[model samples]
Target: MPNDKGRRRRFGSVRKLPSGRFQARYRGPDGLMRTADNTFATQTDADRWLVKQEAKILDGDWTNPDVKIAFGDFAEDWFKDRDYAATTRERNAVVLNRFILPTFSDLPLREITTPQVRRWRTDLIEAGVGAASVAKAYQVLRAILHTAVDDGLIERNPCRIKGAGSVTHTERPFLSVPEVYRLADAVPPHCRALILLAAFCALRFGELAALQRHDIDLEAHTVSVRRAYAETRAEGLIVKAPKSAAGVRTVAFPASLAEELAHHLAEYADAGRTGLVFVGARGGVMRRNNFRRIWLRALAATGLGDVHFHDLRHTGNTLAATGGASTRELMHRMGHSSVRAALIYQHLVNGRDHVIADYVDGQIRKVKRPPHGPSGT
Candidate 1:
């Protein structure tokens, strides 16, 4: 038997198992026993593993469980522990089941090497998975491994290996001004005001869909972004608070726009505080798919080839940028988490720098430059 010090150490020792396979055993932070096998073909391999295990013991990082558990199993445990939204949880579970689990399910959590992760990432890219989706999957794996590390299941998170973040994707798409007007003309008259408010006020689709009669103040010309609609795999449609605390804000509307919304509320809204501002003809929450069909019909009528309804929010940002709104102002209006998002909208506006140049030119022209002194002089 090893000395008492070695036995008491968190990462205990390398010893031969009954089947003659050398193994390293340790006690994890969770107070559970764990073991890692040294399936070396040669004594050199066994020696190397012994050295590593001793070093890990000194560094206080070793915690390899003895029983071989699949990466998929560990990932599931990690997922269950997270306090994610119902919809988010379901979506993450689906992605894991569909994309991640099948590939690494049988592999031991501790045995998953950086090369394997890299190869998996490469395979995902080759299989036409978008970089964003792959990145999200990577995040999920990283999070799982991080929890494992915290639980003392492993010395470190293998998912945090270098070169695990090289994925890239195109930016989110938005719409143009004319496209916005065309989209407005496409939606039904009852929904037109809501659509305009969405595009012009930069309200998210969920926020617009969940808007109640009391949330808007026509006299004050403001709309409060208090709640949003969300759909979960388990619970279906549900109303929830804004995505972030900062998302709860009161947005000032233009006078004309306020009047338009006021007129809409009086004519279409039901006689109750909880009445939805924009609902289906039968007076229920607006379904994205159903609204999408109506939106497509409207786009066709306006002769626009193809555009997403979400693009209208981009149109709102573009319109704000064109109207000389500063990035900070735009961010506030759009409820963006970062100014970088607001900058994308700035690029869509025409004559942006030209307008500044024109202003500079007017100022420079005011100071006639001494009639351009004679060339000889």
Candidate 2:
């Protein structure tokens, strides 16, 4: 007998079945100690599993030995623990209810197989959902299954199965410098500064609309992006932290743009100390639909065709990258969390080879090749 307090206790025991396979037996979650039999290459392998189980129990994160819950019920439990924005929660709920739950809802998670998930994906494609949307639906399913695995409700995630078709990534459309200037000139006088900031500073539309007098420093020529405004189904407009830590940064503006911002502040920013820098005619947050209407009308006025408001931010990134800004500088200015995203903006600018060649030529002319040691003396 082993001391329960001082020594590691051995389970009910390993026994050889009639087929000559060794099986390890252990108590399960039902308060009834049960034995799980499996074939192991050696006794050492069985011992290793016992050690792992002990460690999991000591850490108080042990998963149940058996999984038996329906995936739909488990998903509800998983959703209860997640803290997400109202819109994000709604979007996830829609994906789960419409696409994911119907197939896997009543089935026990432990019984789900890769074949079933593949069939579900095939049905989604046949129903006219794009590959990208299907991929997103797959991601939602994967996340839910991952949570179930973590909680010991399942042994592995079936959604990890491969062979999903390539997901089409949407590229952001950007405007040329000339197009940017034309847009700036065509927008309503009151909205021109906002549009210019979006194109020149790479500010997101939400961040641009959330700007307050206190967030801009005219003397420093910088705008602090601390908050953003987003509309939710339940909440019309709500202010939230800039999406990530990188987003909560102070980005510098061109001196000329800073001057324009100063003038706009003086003319339109309300007498209230905390007034919004850009607002609706009724002194509320600017809505996306209204801004899109204004942008389309401005594009027509400028003789430009079919430009989305988001292109202004892309135009800003392209201008910075093409004007000899380093990747680090672009990342800082654009509030991008990864170098890859910064590179995408840099690649869109074009004509970098010519710029690099001119720089190399200038450097070569300045070098004096070791003072030309006289005729190889």
TM-scores, each model vs. reference: 0.72, 0.73
**Highest-lDDT candidate:** 2
Tens-digit per-residue lDDT, 1-377, candidate 1: 34222233333554555565555555555667555444644334555766676676678775545657788788877778888866688888888887789888889877888788888888998999987788878888888777877876776677755655455544556665445545665678778777778776778888899889998887766687888998776898999887665567666665445556766787777668988888887888887867877877887788766567776777667666766766766666677655444353353244333343233233334443222111211
Off by over 4 Å in 2: 1-67, 163-166, 338-377
lDDT of 2 by residue, 1-377 (tens): 22212223465355544564555656644556655545665555656766665576667656664547888898888877778766677777888898888888999888888888889999999999878778878988888888877876666888865746357667867876556656866776668678878877788999999988998887866688888888877777889886666677666665455556766787767656678899876666788878888888888898777677888888777767766767766676677766444443353256442343233223323432222111211
RMSD of 2: 12.3
Please estimate how well model 1 matches the true structure, expressed as its whole-model Cα lDDT: 0.68
lDDT of every model, 2 decimals: 0.68, 0.70
At residue 92, what lDDT does model 1 achieve? Answer: 89
Question: Model 2 clash pairs?
Answer: none
In model 2, the Cα lDDT at residue 172 comes to: 69
| lDDT, residue 197, candidate 1 | 80
Model 2: number of backbone collisions: 0
